[model samples]
Target: MRLRNKPWAKELIDAHPELIQVQPEHVADQFAQKQPVRLEIGTGKGQFIFKMAQLHPEINFLALEMQHSALAVLLKAQVDAQLPNLQLVVANAENLQALFAGWHFSEIYLNFSDPWPKTRHEKRRLTYSSFLTQYQQLLVPDGVVQLKTDNRHFFEYSLISMNQFGMQFQQLSLDLHHDDTTWAAANVPTEYEDKFSAKGQPIYGVRAVFHQAKG
Candidate 1:
């Protein structure tokens, strides 16, 4: 579901300039934590990040969301939360290489990304091999990408895709909510996660460690 443009979006973003980053240069200065940084792609309305930032203040968070309206809504929550460890980047996943060329992250998150169900549209999926390649470039050696989604087909597709790319699977839970593990207890629910889980929909998740190329 596409969000309509909010009239106050620009004003909201401009008001919290400290929380928003337009480029890579801005990120380094604003996020100076010595602990490794974690990136979350497509942070819709920001529920999971809002909680993650609070739970793990030791690790800095960089959330990417292209939609201004969604960012605007998140801005309000961010301001209210007042988490210095959290930062926002308004950009698309495809441009991550150019956006943070020399930078790398210890971890990345993809939560409830668009299924892009059509066979021809597989390239657009966040878990597609092309995006996975980009992610591999941005990740530090042994860094991992954690993903959660309610779509079964997309989950299976991502597992196969990561295997083909030589990613080492650390964890794979087909029914995340039912799993009584440490990660499940530590899991922060995204907006979609709450909705789907309330309706008894099982969440699928995977933690894949990228294969670093030999120098």
Candidate 2:
């Protein structure tokens, strides 16, 4: 789906450096404390990450989005809410290696990312091997990756991709909403997840950790 362009979006995001960084070279001081940082890539409208930050004030949340309009909406709310632990960034995931140089996160999230269903666009998937490598580099040893999506095919592909990358799944839920596990009890919904799940579509989720190698 083509996103509606907001001509004023860039200006709004640019005006607030503390709330959102438009050109983040490195993950420099987004928050005051050196708490455990969790990154959510493709933060659509910032629903999940924003709420996560609110729930876990001890942990810092960084939301990275490629869209100005969607991010601007979140920035507006962030400005008013003023959650010190929550920060936003406008950057592509492909640049994460450089952006997170010398910085590592305890956890990473992929919330309702674009499926890029076509086989030719396989590399564009967030769970692709290249992106997985980037995540591994930016994540601390034994760091966790949590993902939620409504697309089954994409979810299957992601499982295969991550498995091929030697990442092991700590938790897997076919119907997250219906799952009665403790992990599912902590499930948060993105905008897309809320919308689709309301229509009786089951949400899929996975918690994975990169395989640790012995020295």
Candidate 3:
């Protein structure tokens, strides 16, 4: 998702300190409720996370996306909606360990993440081992990581990476929209997923858990 820079984006996001977080150190305290936390990485336009927060009021949602311009659009909606359980942050993935330091979530969501298709850029993919390590550190033991994507290469790469990282697959669907599975029945569509699926493309999805610490 590319957009012309919004100069007011930062100031607008910063103004709503309770709903939009500026410091990673302050993320843990953003929510008004003490509930099980779930995180969504790369929240593009925030459709999925926002809907998730609405659907699951029992859980606190923290959305992490790197693009301030993209997040600003969603942040405005979140502020207007006044969803007490949802919080947004513009931050880099590399600093996740420090961002959520002393915090662990119940689940992490990766929705329509960039594939970083070039072989040389494999490390940049969200499912790369380094990112998995961060997810492991930020999730409770055996916590689930759910991923949904429209890219076959990314879906395949993520499955292999998660397997190599000692994550046990609990559920997987090669074609989430068409598959007749319980997980697919409750699927949420990100804009990217909806656009691709509308063109008859299959959406891939997986739910996996870190069975044990590896290294």
Candidate 4:
């Protein structure tokens, strides 16, 4: 996860100011009337988020990553793309609640997130119930969380955790390659996704919708 030595990291740090920062209180009001905000928790190298920003100019995007170097790459990409609606946050995913207040984001993206395959590390998985609660706090009513991964075990574990949290799976695909219809529209292949898919890996993914509880 440490990318300090990467050449691209230094370049990103030098050009960081172009990226916007969203404090916890301002997140909701910033996108109140304009367009729904979409967040990507772990934007590796910036390929996916940049594409999303390019495709949807109206929607605001927040790319969060813990590694300073990786964040720099994303920031540089945003700068290069001249994307006005994109923001970058350098923080751990665990502190997402502390970074944004109230219901703000309409959609959340988790592309090729760390599997944390070991049993002891299950809690660290981004789709775990504990993380889902944090996401729920920031997500708007009926907000959706979209996730994709090549690890079947992690996908199954996520499905279980999502169900336990009472989130509904609006779309689910076991073998992304075999399902061309959905894949055609849904596939915006991230850097990791492209790498894995080219190697003939079977990608699995699910888009879960969060329905607010009635009082």
Each candidate's clash count: 0, 0, 0, 0
Worst 10 residues of 2 by lDDT: 22-31
lDDT of 4 by residue, 16-95 (tens): 54464434344433332467789998887878888888888889888888777677777766667667677777667777
**lDDT score at residue 173, model 3, on the 0-100 scale:** 90
Candidate 1, residues 8-124, lDDT tens digits: the string is 988888887788865656776776576789999999899988889888989999889988888778888888877888999887777788888877899999999999999999999
Put down candidate 3 lDDT per residue, 1-215, tens digits, no spaces.
Answer: 67689998989987988788766677667778798999998997898898999999999998888899999989989978998899898887776888888888999999988889999998899999999999989998878999998889889989999999989999999899988888888887888888999999999899999987469
CA-lDDT, candidates in order? 0.88, 0.88, 0.88, 0.79
Best by TM-score: 2
Residue 145 of model 4, lDDT score: 95
Residue 190 displacement (Å), model 1: 0.1
Cα deviation of 176, candidate 1, in Å: 0.5
Positional deviation of 50 in candidate 3, in angstroms? 0.4
Pull out the clashing pairs in model 1.
none
Q: Which candidate, 3 or 4, would have the higher TM-score against the true structure?
A: 3
What lDDT tens digits, residue by residue, belong to model 2 across residues 1-215?
Answer: 44598888888877888778866654457686888889999997888888898899999899998888888888888989999899888888876898877778999999888999999999899999999999999999999999999999999999999999999999999999999999888877888988999999999999999999899
Estimated TM-score for each candidate: 0.95, 0.96, 0.94, 0.88
**What's model 4's lDDT at 72?**
76
In the predicted model 4, the residue pairs found to clash are none
User: Which consecutive 10 residues in model 3 have the weakest lDDT in total?
Assistant: 21-30
Model 1 worst lDDT window (10 residues): 23-32
> Per the 3 Å backbone cut-off, how many clashing residue pairs does candidate 3 have?
0
TM-score of model 4 vs. true structure: 0.88
